[model samples]
Target: MVRWLLVLLMFTGMADAAPPSLYSLLSQGQYQPPMQVMLQLEQNYPGVITQFDIDVQNGELIYEFNMLDPDAKTTVGFAFKASNGSLLEQKVAKLESDDLEELAAVTLMRQKQLKFSQLITLATGELDAYLTEAQLDHDLGISYLELKLLSAAGRHKLAFDIANLRPLPLLKWD
Candidate 1:
């Protein structure tokens, strides 16, 4: 695991020589850019680092990373400059998810003819939204809404009845 640790250290820690010309970090779900990574990126690249934005596009192994205008909320897909923080190679992609899937807990109440394939797609969408919206930013186990969304697709029924289970307020995923 020493090699892994070294790579992780490289995320935020200083390089023995210079900023990595090209680099990558581990991510299974949400790509929370570690503070150390940002610091090192800034130190090595200076003004080019700019701001980091985290997002998940389903059906993908890696999350699509982006830089944003801190004030304007403008998004760019590629490199920023050390000279002036100008975003470069900014090719705009069409979309992440075009399907209308929702994770709202109320989805369980709907009994519809959504296909098995369609169900998984919808459930995945809802799961993504729920996880991103939770106060803690993640839930280890499936909750009422997640199960319900799945049920709409015939994957699984709402296992536990959540009568009084009000979901906590959504938290900002920093």
Candidate 2:
């Protein structure tokens, strides 16, 4: 199957590798965790913080936060300077109905006290994998966390329920 072939290519190192995690930068003690800033923004703007990542631009670490603002019905991206957690840039786009549904699921997930970073930590610890990225995803009315990971075996895309951290039926490279 084509999916099998893609998984094979990923495991064989033929696929593009993911960027390093923002956690590594935190461990280095040179940069503050951008989640705090994200929380602050969420409080001010009242939105769903959906994804977080660190991007290197011109040799500088840029912490990016993606969220959905319900009142405004917009998807927003906030880029912050890694060192001081200062806002660098913000981009906003209109959210479609599908996005609103995902946001609703994520909001319910928050009621259950699910944190994306905590899930990544628990999963990586259990699987002995390195976390590359975690994003909120919805498919066929199922809301899950899509985790991109790297390990000695290979790159893997694992999915887990947003509320309970239960593993979902997803592709496994190993």
Model 1 Cα lDDT, one tens digit per residue, 1-174: 999888987986664564321121122323333333334443443112222332322322122223322223233354433223333345433323321122212223223322222322333444422111110011333223322221212222222222223432341112
Poorly placed runs, candidate 1 (over 4 Å) = 1-33, 58-174
lDDT of each: 0.29, 0.69
TM-scores of all candidate predictions against the true structure: 0.19, 0.64
Q: How far off is residue 15 in model 1, in Å?
A: 47
RMSD (CA, angstroms), candidate 2: 9.4
Clashes of each: 5, 0
In model 2, where is the ten-residue run with the lowest total lDDT? 18-27
TM-score of 2: 0.64
Candidate 1's displacement at residue 130, Å, is 14
